[model samples]
Target: MHVLVVYESLWGNTEQVARAVADKLGSVGTVDVVDSDAAPITVDGYDLLVVGGPTHAFSMTRAATRAEAVKSQSALHEPARGIREWLNLLGRPSAAIPAIAFDTRVDKPRMPGSAAKAAKHELRSMGFGTTVKQETFRVHGYEGPLLDGELERASAWADEVIAALGLGSRADR
Candidate 1:
């Protein structure tokens, strides 16, 4: 199966999670990891889609950035578009193939939810089934030193996604 993992990161934390996810999917089949803002991906080309981003101020940071871009008419350092807009424009994929969503955030004692939840909701509206509950990996600081064990957890989560989606071993695709 061909899987596409697209992500938007502020301080690289989200990318790390994306890579770990893609690695696990790679074990089962072909995987492509792309920046969410690069271009709108055609979901029809892949069997599964994984979308992720970073959380800032309790919401996906990329969404605010995209909004800023639209109002400012200038490209911002973050990106011009977000996963939500991309998925909305892509319409629905042919199959109900499962998709997974994840995010990276500064672990705050006050806040529990992550940006991935919003992304997952948007994906569902766009007609993709989700596998493995939405997840969040923690970061130590704003610029981020990802918290310990997050990568391992990401890989493990990917394994779960594969299993939940009924995908076979890596070699079988």
Candidate 2:
């Protein structure tokens, strides 16, 4: 199985989770990990695609929200285009590719929404088959060192995704 893992991260938390996911997926098959800004505009060749980003304003970051992140976080990397824009530009896939979506969000009292949820919807709209429920990894704050164990959780989630997609032959590794 070939897998592509793409992510948009303002403060790197999501990127770290994406890497963990990719690393775990690597055990099952070949995996290519890239930032959303560098991801392909079309989904082809890969059997599975995993996409993730930081939750901004309750969902995927827009240009305005990215600007806000840049203004508020000194260490944040300015991305050319976030997952929202990348997905928008990525037209519907020609064939059904199994996909999973995840997001990094602040561990607030009541987080309003989820980027993963919105991303899943977007992927389905783009004609990709979503094989796993959307997942969220928590952060302590906006520019965060993710909540404890989130990376490990992300890796575990990757294993689950592999199993769900019936690509579990190498998951034990």
Best by lDDT: 2
TM-score of candidate 1 relative to the true fold: 0.85
Q: Which ten residues in a row have the lowest lDDT in candidate 2?
A: 164-173
Model 1, global lDDT = 0.77
lDDT of 2 at 138: 94
Q: TM-score for all predictions?
A: 0.85, 0.94
lDDT string for model 2 (1-173, tens) is 88889899988999999999999988888999999889998778888889999888888998888887888776468788989999989877777898899999988665889999999999988889985899999998788889899999999998898778878757354
Instruction: Give the alpha-carbon lDDT of every model.
Output: 0.77, 0.88
Candidate 1 minimal-lDDT segment of 10 residues: 68-77
lDDT of candidate model 2 versus the reference: 0.88
Per-residue lDDT of candidate 1, residues 6-102 (tens digit): 8886556788899998998887789989887874557777888899987655666656654553355332246556665666567677878777898
Off by over 4 Å in 2: 170-173
